[model samples]
Structure formats: structure tokens, C-alpha cells
Target chain A: MATHEEITGSLQAFGEGYQKNKKLKIMNKDWDRVILIKAADVDSQHTLILKNGELTVTEGTPAGDPDLVVTADSETLADLFYGDITPTEPYMNGTLVIKGSEDDIVRLDFISLMIWGE
Target chain B: MKRVVSVSLGSSGRDHKVQVELLGEQFEIERLGMDGDFDRALAKLQELDGQVDAIGLGGIDVYVYAGNKKYAFKDGLKLMETVKKTPVVDGSGLKNTLERETVNYLLRETNYLNKDTRVLMVSAVDRFGMAQAFTTAGCDVTFGDLIFAAGIPYPIKTLEELEEMAGKLLPEMTKLPFHMLYPTGKKQESRDEEKAKKYAQYYRDADVIAGDFHFIKRYLPDNLNGQIIITNTTTAADVEFLRQSGASRLVTTTPVFEGRSFGTNVMEGVLVALLGKPWEEVTPEDYMDLIERLEFKPRIIDMAS
Candidate 1:
């Protein structure tokens, strides 16, 4: 399990990383969506709002429906946002589960790739 | 006379039709690219059902093997399920046998490959036999399945590691849409320079680059420095691109017809047509036997002056 502050800090850092990545901004200019990240182990949830080529992270559930939902252990979620591990690693191992359309999932993966080069 | 049609999700620009005599049989071979439209591909398969002698599913793999475990792709399986009468194949049947022989042929007939060669296989799960052949030949092989397919930087160095990774990843990954796993439609026609530059070291460090042409071309660096590329489904334009990229040689496992090598799916469809049996009943030994009788030789090009 992870502390609430740690999870929120990691999510904020992930948003900051995306904000600073020019290539990711350009690539995702037209991709606007609300993504819900649920830490299964910690029973915590966070919302990632992407609109107009910008990303913002907020703790807790979103006010409306989310276009995508990513479910993973608290540690895995923290590590993913902290850039310690890639989503591919956990996703491949069945530790991370994402529910969304294929296009949105690929775009999210590409965002991670752009933010943390291969 | 028999006819075989390959309904593909690739770019329409690469569609081709040819008439060839094989093993004393006259056959009309055609490849129709659907530009990544799944509905269109399904409709095409329905239209061709019971009409063609055999159908080949292109641009998507119905199954990929790792070790002895085989995983099925959801989209590929859906495309296959549309047909009722004609046999359909996604090329996995021939990739295992034909690609292994191609490696052995190169070892026996050409100087391009040797024990000292450093090989980079872009995606091994799709062609496990070729990967095993390189390892069996005692060549240093780096399987780039994770690196190329998932944008992960990890390079699997042995068949065991690849199999282990496959066991963990492939089950869930196969359920995703085919395009998420592969490049299709017009996406095949372009390369991402940023990705190419980021992963160029893997290409520059290898003596031989092998695997799917699209995966190889997706991140192909501008300069290969005389590296040899071993793949199939190369059009004349792909050959010219390789030559300009400084590749020394090109080896296609399938024989080239009308200036391009047909995909393993097309070749496998041809084999199925000649075998005159259901695809499930046909075995690897059958494919090898026909290959030996036909004296099928790989199409090798010397790109370096």
C-alpha cells in the first residue's frame, strides 16, 4: 500500500512531466479525454483531465464519466507515474489493467513513450 | 486452374495480381490491401468465401507462437471467422518452416551470416522458428520484441527469455485490436524519425536485421552501414529504400514475383491450394515436403556494389 500524499505527488509529477514534454503536447493536441486511475491496493482513485493539449491531475473521482480507466496496484501506479517503471511492463505482466477503446489506450502508451524516451 | 486471394489490412497502394505456374499448376494470385478497415476486410472475406480456392489473411496474424504455446489475435480470428468454405491462413503456418530453412540456406550458401554475426530480430514471437534457428546456429541474437512492439527498451537475448516474456504478455496483449500491436494501412508507408533515431543504436549494433519488414522499416535509421536485412514482403520501393539506407544485402524468405516478394500468408495460401487439404490437417512436414519438391529458393539481392 502507498500513502495518499505519495500517490498524489506521483500523479502531479506525471502531469508536470507531460506539460514539459513538447513532443507529447504536439502529438496529443487533438486527444482530449478524462482518464481515471484507480489504485487497487490502496483503494484510491485519481482523475487525469486532458483538454486543449494540456493535462491536469486531480485526486479522487471525476465529476463525470471517464473515457478510460486504468487499474493497478498502488506501488505500480506510483512507479508508473514516477517514471521508475513503464506501463508496458505491468500491462504485459497482467498487473495493470486498462479499460478503454484501443485508440485511446495506444495514445496513452505513446504519451508515456514520448515523455520517457524508449 | 486455382485462384488464391489475400485480403489484407495493409495499404491499398501495395495491392498486386499475378499469374504464375507452380508445380505444374496454373494459379492466379492476388493481394488486396484494405487500408486497415476491419469492416471492409470482413466484407471482402465474406465476398470471397467459396469463390477462391484459398484465402490468406494479411496485415494481421491469426496466431503467434512462443515455445509451444500459441496465442490468438482477436481481430485476426474475427477476420478468419467470416469465411465458410475457403481455407484461410495468416502465414504462421509457413513462417516457422520457411524462415528456418531460409536461415539454414544463408548459412550454407552465403557469407552474410556466420557464428560471429550479431542478429537483431525485431519481433520473435511472430517468427519463433527463425529466432530459434539463429540461436541454434550459435549466432548472437537480440530479440527486440519488447523494444519494437511495446516501445520498451528491454532487448531479450535468448529464446528462453522470449518465451518467458511471451507467456506473461501475449495472453492479454493478443486480445487487443490488431492495429494496436502492428502498423497497418497508410501507417506502414511512413516511418517515425524520432523513434528511428531513439532506437537507432539497436540497428547500428547488429550485423543482420531480421523480422517483419514493417517493424524493421518503422524505426529504420537513415544509415545502416552495410547491415544485412532478412525479411519478406518487400516491394521495389522497399528495396530501393534499403539500398539508399546503406544496407549491404536483402534476403527474402519467399520468392519474389513481379518485382516483390509475396508475404508468407500468400505463399502459404499457394501451398494450401496445392496441398488440396484443409489447413488444420496440413502439418509442418507437409509444408517442408512441398517446399523441397518445389525447390523454393529465397530471393537474395546484393545491394552493395
Candidate 2:
């Protein structure tokens, strides 16, 4: 059993790797409205929003109008970047869901393949 | 006892293409160059009325290369209309084509190849037909990097260069333009079986191995005992190596010829080999009976000619 901090660190490393590779640059350059939704927080608790590369929470705040929302478990999210599960298949199978930006979904799918080596 | 018919559609020269196989022995293949209006293509097929058991077409690569999606749906609809009774298999439906229903149809009706006999397929589109052939023949396939994403091993610019690479790398290969590997090593002993072992996991179960020329080279087991089919490729040497490598047969189409897909060639070639007839001489009658026996009646005519 790995610690949550360890898993988050791994995901952050992968995110940095993807950034270094320019595989998954967030389109439209608006990081303030981007949110990562964990599966455990389906009720909208623990929403991690990135603003100027800083993290904050809109916990219990009326589910704000974010530009993009990525929803998946931490493990699945980690594996998404690692290329183990196909994003398209997962999306189709309901393992992952993205809202607020179809373009972001496309970009995510393309970048996921580049980052994950699929 | 269903029959099998395979068809392909894509641009004549580009790499993107599709192949579809239907269960039965007979086939009705209607091919048109990527040129001409869809109406004209429909006219050509109308002439073959009641003659085809299945229909395949080509040209997606040209569209992708040119970034034009025009006429694609029209072409598909036109072909669909022509082969009203035939099952009109095309490359896009690979997943649906390879179901248990289809495989059982292929095995029960045909006196299929059993790995020892060499069968050749030309211009197989993508990896679908090759996968089906793998299930039918029970032998391993190898190829070069053009099919896989891994990159070409040898530097080749011309067909002759490819052939040279094939001879120098794989002397025992009997199939050319295989989607497997272009040998960088001469002796099978020098060839890296570990690499083969590592890559085999990706396609150990796949009937067809898809990769660039190098991907084929990477995945091929050192001990191969069957036939090979070459799809879209440019290297002549790879073809030469395949011929040397105990490949029981080799199938190829004219270079850059798209409308008349290599997949159709693969299907017709295998069927000819199975029926023991010269490939060119094999006729629609041979396939028609298979379709009739299989009961894979074509869809009712959706539109008038």
C-alpha cells in the first residue's frame, strides 16, 4: 500500500515529465479555471484548482464554473498519464469523464498517448 | 459452412487503407481508383450486378494526406448499394468481421492452410486480415518497421535498398514487404531473440503484427514456420528477404496502386491457394458458391441504381 503523498508525488512527476516533453500543454493558457476531480470526491469536495501554478480548493463551494474538469481516481489518473489504460476506451467505459471542454478532451487524449507511450 | 471474402478501400499510394473480410469462399470485388465521381463508381459496380458476393473499396490515405473527407461517405454508400446481396465487407469493419461467427464459418467450409503451406497476401490493409490469416494458418508472421511506430532500422530510400536490407538481414525469409522486420543482423544466431521475445508479448495473440519495418523485425521469433502477407510498403529488399525466409508464399500489388487494394489481393490470393488455382485465373464463381453455402446473403438493396 503506497501513501497518498507518494502517489500524488508520482503524478506530479509524470505531469512535469509531460510538461517537459510538451506532450500535454493546457490549451488556451487559462490554468485558473482548471480542476482535477478525484473519484472519491464525487460530491465535489476536495476540488484542486490550479492558479498560476498554485493549488487551492473550492471545497463545498457550489461547484464553480471551471473551464475544465478531469474526473478519475488517483490511481487511474496516474495510469492515464502512464499509458496503461487507453483514454478513449476508459472514457467510453465510464472510468474517466471530462467536462467543460471537448477540445481539452481531444488534447488530453493526444497528449496522454505521447506521455504514456501508448 | 460459410465462406470468406475480403475487401480493402483507400487511396492508391498513401499508407492509410482498410481491409474487410467476410466468411465464404467466393468474393465479388469492385474497385475504383480514387478519381472519378461517386456516381461513376456506382455505375462501374452496377455492371457487375449479381456477380459479387462481397465488395471492398480503397482511398482513405489520399483523403488523410490531402485532408479531405469529401466523398468518403458517398463512396461507402455507393458500394453498399452495388453489392445488395453480398455481405460487402470493407476495412473499417475488422472488429465485427473477426467474431466467432465469422471464424467458424471460415474453418468449417474451407480446406484451410495449416502453417506448413505457404500463402501470400499482397497489400494487406492495416493489421486486420493478417490477424485473421494468422488464426487460419497457425504460423508466425514477421515484418519491417513501416507498419509499426518504432522506426525503420536500416536506412532505405529506394525499393532496391529495401531488398538489399532484406537479403543482408534475413536470408531465410521467403515473403517480401512483410509488415514484420527488415533484418539488421545476418545470422539468425546473431538476431536478437530476446528482442523478439520482448515484443512478442504485444502480438503473441494477434493474428497480424502491425509495426513499421523495424517493428516486424523486432517481434519476429527466430524460429518462424509459415507464410507472410505484405501490405503497404516501398522496400524491395524486404520482399526479397521474405522470399528467402521459408515464407511459403508472397503476395504483392503494384506500387502506389491504391483503388485496387492489396487487401483484395491478399484475400483472392489466399483463396486461390486454397482452391489450388492460379490467382488471376480464379473467378467469382469459385467464391459465389461459398457465399451461397454460407448463407451470408447481402443486405437488401437500399437504393436504386
Which candidate has the top score in DockQ?
Answer: 1
lDDT of each: 0.89, 0.38
Q: After superposition, how far is residue B75 of candidate 2 from its true place, in Å?
A: 19
What TM-score does chain B alone reach in each candidate, compared with the true chain B? 0.99, 0.28
Ten contiguous residues minimizing lDDT sum, candidate 1 chain B: B168-177
* CAPRI quality band, candidate 1: incorrect
Across residues B151-269, which tens digit of lDDT does each residue of candidate 1 receive?
65667898987887677567666766778879899889999677799889999999999999999998999999899999999999999999999999999999888998999999999
**TM, every model:** 0.79, 0.30
Worst 10 residues of 1 chain A by lDDT: A109-118
For candidate 2, lDDT tens digit of each residue in B26-45?
33333434342345545655
Q: What value does DockQ give for candidate 1?
A: 0.11
